[model samples]
Target: MPIVSTSTSAFYERARASMKDLRSQAETLQAQLGSGEKLTRASDDPVAAARLRTLSRLESLSSIDTTNADRANADLSLADSAISNMATTIIRAQELATQAASSTLTDQQRAGIGAELDQIHDDLISLANSRDSNGHALFGGESAGNAYSVDASGNAVYIGTNSTGDLPIGDGQTVARSITGPQIFSFTDASGNTTDVMATVKALSDALKGGSTDPAGAAADALESLKQGIDTLTTGQTVVGTRLAWLDVVSERRSTLTELRTTEEASLGGTDIASTVAQLQQTLTVLEASQASFTKLSGLSLFDNLR
Candidate 1:
């Protein structure tokens, strides 16, 4: 018969290694509980960590999109309000024109109407040069200053760009932030001629103030042109309204996407507190039992048995 022998040193080494492993596991679970995250570092879960990084970058970009959408919404709403006021002003000008066209009125009365028309002309010029939220031209199409400027002859001339420029809202989309001065005021007249709201009003004011042989005839002619100008303004209002609707749609979509991303972030990296705590308790219980067993085994000796 052959006897197999096991060294006491080997037994101690094996027992110490097992207890060390259990202690290391208990410390790791405790760390996870303290941190409130599943991953201690990128090395702990490389795939989950990388995915979290990507989600974080996407969140930052979404925040920027939200800001841009808000700015566009504000500028467009301002443009809509200004357009409505201008339409009201034009309607008042039409009323004045109607009164001036009356033959029953004396020359003096017509002159008084002409004076009021002059004030209206000035008001239209001021409206055209209205400022935006940034103190720049609202209808100037990205101009740093006013949209219209008074010339040497007191004519309001357009000094703005033709394009209002586009703003990026998100999800591969863009919106025109504003309408240009020419877009709101300029149109084709019945005489197959190019004319604008400011020019039409200025011409009528000049005619009524003794610049024409027949003031009544001039006022009648201006009525048709003014109607055309109103049409142009109405068209601009429709465009602004459509863009605002589009912004609302995009904003809703962005909100939904943001929520989805947030949910994914929580699922990928956030720790499950209830499950983690239970796991920690089980590990601690096993570690304590191993420690007690190791203490008793390490203290036992063959020498004591021989005595």
Candidate 2:
């Protein structure tokens, strides 16, 4: 019968396994301390890991919304500045119209006034076709080119799209980034006919230049058209102001929500340093004791073999 040497070999294998298990536990604890994270892998806590993933996804979405909001606000600010300048120019034109309506002005004086009116018309068209910070047409909606261009008839025509290009500022929220050219420059007269500021100004200028039979009537018509232009601009400005207020509210709410997500993510994934430290110490103590016992047991086995 072969002499059984199973006891010593079996004890050695068991001792090695025990040491490996102890070391593994200690290493895991140390890693947690080093990383300041409780769950190094998804397997550590499946529910927590899943929640973390959801939070991460939401964070990414919020970031995108923030970017959109920022760009939209910038565009809106640019629009407001441009429109304010336009209002000022239109006011000046209105004053000129009032003065030209007087019969005391000579033909040469009217001609000079018409020349100035032409300049104002050109400036107004330039304002209508202005670009935003990103160089896209501010009043052109989604069009990349100039917002207003003259057609064959010499009247300024809207060459851009009607859409103001609404952008997603946050979940379930969209806003118009800018006002379209037509919204600011076009109007309907009391007679229910559509008219544009450019046409009104240009026609007035021509009447003065060509010495219309009724210079006073021509100037009066131009003044009425300018009055309508100012009203249209005022309404557009109000709409833009309202939109800007909405953006402010939405931006604040998003910031609060992002902060909440950050807190929740930390709660689910962050490590407990004090508890982990205690656990690591306990594991080390146990491992050291086991090592000592294994050393004594191995010495006894060797001694018995010699015997």
Candidate 3:
């Protein structure tokens, strides 16, 4: 049989190595507990760290999308309110036209109605050029200035884009921020002629102010155009209302997606406090026992044992 002899230096080396390993493990567990994260560096779990980074980027983009959705909602709401006011003003103008169409009314009375109609035209123009939440033209279709500009002849002309730009809400979806002025104010009449609300009102006002050979005839002719213009406004309102409803749906979907992302983020990177605490306690206990045993064995010399 071969006899096995252990050297004191080798014994000490083995005992020290074992104690060092236990101490290292205890320190690592304590660090994990302090940081409240399972990973101290990307190298700890490369795939998980990469996934966390991707999620962080998506979260940042989602914040931006939320801001854009809010702006779109605000601008659309402003457009809706302005359109409502314009409809009311046009209806009032229609009432005045009805009074002007009466043959019983004298030219003087018609002139007074024309004066009110002039003010109504101006009010309509102002409403058409209403400002949005960001102070840009509300119905200008992305134009920074007024949607309708007054020429030297005092006629309102459209100087805005034909199409309103779309804003991205989220999930590959977009919404138009507003409807253009012409969309609400211009349409084809029964006579197959294209006319706008502002122009029709201006013509009647001019005619009633003695610019026409027959004031009552002009006022009668304008009734049909005014009715059609009101219809256009109503249609525009419906479009805006539909867009607003779509925004609501998109907002709800976004909220749901955000909740899902939050849950995934927690599952992927959040620390397990209960498990970590238990591991730390077990490591500490083992480290303490190994340390005490090492100290006792280190102090036990051959001569001491013999004595």
- For each candidate, what TM-score against the reference? 0.87, 0.85, 0.87
Model 1 lDDT on a 0 to 1 scale: 0.88
- Across residues 101-183, which tens digit of lDDT does each residue of candidate 1 receive? 87887778888888887888899889888887778888999888889999999899999988987888887889988899888
Residue-level lDDT for 39 in candidate 2: 90
lDDT of 3 at 253: 82
| Stretches of model 2 off by over 4 angstroms after superposition | 1-18, 285-307
Query: Compared to the true structure, candidate 3 yields what TM-score?
Result: 0.87
Each prediction's Cα lDDT score?
0.88, 0.90, 0.89
Instruction: Between candidates 1 and 2, name the one with more favorable lDDT.
Output: 2
Clashing pairs in 3: none
Runs of candidate 3 with Cα error greater than 4 angstroms are 1-36, 302-304
Q: List candidate 1 segments past 4 Å from native.
A: 1-36, 296-307
lDDT string, candidate 2, 1-307, tens digits: 8896668779989999999999999999999899988899999999999999999999999989998899999999999999999999999889989989998998888888899989999999999989987898999999999998987766788989989888898778899999998899899876788998888888888888875888778998889889999999999988888899999999999989999998898789987889889999999999999999999877774556685
RMSD of each: 2.8, 3.7, 2.7
**Residue-wise C-alpha lDDT for candidate 3, range 1-307, written one tens digit per residue:** 9999998889889988987887787777778778766777889889988988898888888898889889889999999999999999999999999999999999999999999999999999999999988899989998999999999988999999999989888778888988999999999988788889999999999999999998999999999899999999999999999999988888898888889888777667766778878887888888788888878887887887584
